[model samples]
Target: MKSPAPTTNRRNGSFGHRSTPEHLGYSPTSGHNSSKVSRRNPMAATVMSVIGIFTACFTPPDTNNSKSFVDSEEFKSSSVASEASRSGSHKARGSSRGVSITLHNSIQGEPAIVKFTMEEIFQVTRNFSPSFKIGQGGFGAVYKAKLLNGTVVAVKRAKKSVNEKHLGVEFQSEVQTLSRVEHLNLVKFYGYLEQEDERIIVVEYVPNGTLREHLDCNHGSILDLASRLDIAIDVAHAITYLHMYIDRPLIHRDIKSSNILITEKLRAKVTDFGFSRQAPDIDSGMTHVSTQVKGTAGYLDPEYLRTYQLTEKSDVYSFGVLLVELVTGRRPIEPKFELKERITAKWAMQRFIEGEAISVLDPKLDQTAANSLALEKILELALQCLAPQRQNRPNMKRCAEILWTIRKHYRELSASEFRSFSTSSQRSASTKE
Candidate 1:
């Protein structure tokens, strides 16, 4: 049996009430513990369409021909050459490889961000040694760096020539979003450095591997049902924080298991904001932000994919796929499986609706009563999140609340079963005596 998972404590009002506010387009419905979502106003759809057209017409072409980040290169400047040529002297020297600078805590009550010199970066990463390399993503390479003060941080080095156009904007967007948000379940940003031809982001180092690695058994230990539940709650809380608590609501365009970093204690922290976008303000009468689709292939929202409209519900859709992935122990896309079973979420949902919910669960997990109950409830919630229409999906807050309730019921069922077994065992002992 897997060891017990550490319980995560919720703040006084962080989880919010069981009932979501009606103003946020969520209201309790009669059956199946589902909620009603209000559709986007007609005006909002018209505005979104206009915005999409404008973006399509005005946005510059992506001239960087490399298909993937790993193969990407800094393209020669043409019409955009003016932006690169403004600084003439810095171009010839290339990378100032041996320069290092000192950074002091300049902010009150917070660690002020100062640029890490190229020399300091080289020392910590051993000149981006293969062994020091931890992971790679759409942005660039990530290395584990240990500072002189005994502080360890994850140094994310942007792909070379990231300062040119779209990639440059993405780098800045991630830095700005990371600097603004702070939450236990969200990776904390320490600082950022943008020197000539080098762009790096430093954040808190999460030691344990990603949730995907654990799910794939690359970490050599099976994650228990209780731990998975906690992870789900942790991610939901993080997304809820981004959606509602932050100064500006944000959409985590990429919320896949790979982006969810696990700590030593099995807690999850959401990372990688390269594709994150500020959500449209509902109060300001904007219904959805028009942006190009950005997310993992299997986890992208169907509505967002079709309309070029982005919203918080897009994140909710990905979360639903994640929940299914959690319980099934399968990737969102299982290409090697049988044709009908290729799409994990659809296959699992079919099993769920067909009254074989337990059949879709991960075979590694024990089929105990509590596990069965939690499985059913989680699938029910996942179905809501995977709804075809954004209006049919519940908000992130509701998802967190539902998971909280499910956890409570699971614990209660487990305790009840334990007590029953204990009493029965006592009776058997006395009779044997």
Candidate 2:
């Protein structure tokens, strides 16, 4: 018989109030347990959709283990053309043949010759000085560097030393996976340099910082309802692209707000692939190859954690938690709340069923003036995504479609309200005349 999994200390306080398998109306003996099966009911679906809409508006907390520090100095640019010439032609290198380097653009579906030297990168990033630093993550520090061509880029430099076997494996896996996949939602990799003891990846610089920064800084007030919906749609679209449009489905194990970066136009781009993995074939009944339990605390999939099996549905589960943070503007795990009451999804879902969804809305949102019914629908979607069972969560495509539908509905309602106001004003003017 397989041994029971060892328990890690539950973070974000104790597991919130347990919804007994019986209370949710499922039999524990039914192979997969009650919580897993209970999420498939139509009622649960309705609740999830409603919660999902509202939850998509809130900001996700920063759970990244890396620390971001700023540098006071500016980076000096070096001519890329000169550097390319110094490195010698790709043809020459290929003929000489050491480790053949081929550059390919995954998103554009094309290949190009790439030649960059370590010296050029160093000059661009000011030797990875603290001043140019933008952020740091579990993988490495991100520095804002300007190339000689006047192009600004974000350079990710891996941690100085990784002795742990798991961490080293994860680093190599990310480098291998991200180097090949390309999508608009994903951060673009210009190229990478692997040295004896260090690795660095060059990518496009997203100026607006992370979605979490915007949400937390403004307390969600700056993001009006429409803007919030747009962000949700953008992120959903990116995830949909990853799951369906890519040659091989990729699962972003860590799908929190921090991973979602905002461009200058406030467009959402899902970044960070350090914890991502490819999906396995469908007939194999495996979405991902079996691996160690790897993910953040609140956003981890309960099923995957228990089974030590990864899947695309794991991404869905994390997205659900993100949705909750969006709508309720609450952290996945709140230390201020009671140990058994800190889980956002469980508490919020219970309140939703009790028809007290207004209390769950972010105080920053003007729900009284907004369409309360629509918000409720979004909440329902979030609940469904957070379902304990992987099969119960909606696919990323469906989730994006649902969010798009909500956006359309809001536009129609706004148009109607404008028409009504115009008609009323015209009538009052005629009366005055």
Best by TM-score: 1
Cα lDDT tens digits, model 2, 328-383, are: 76777776998544777767776766667678777777764344545666766776
lDDT of 1 by residue, 198-243 (tens): 8888776767878888888888999999999999999998999888
After best superposition, candidate 2 residue 429: deviation in angstroms? 8.1
Q: TM-score of each candidate?
A: 0.77, 0.72
> Which candidate number has the best lDDT?
1
CA lDDT of every candidate? 0.70, 0.61
> Cα RMSDs of all predictions?
12.2, 12.2
Model 1 CA deviation exceeding 4 Å by range: 1-113, 161-164, 426-433
* lDDT (Cα, 0-100) at 23 in candidate 1: 43
Error of 2 at 71 (Å): 25
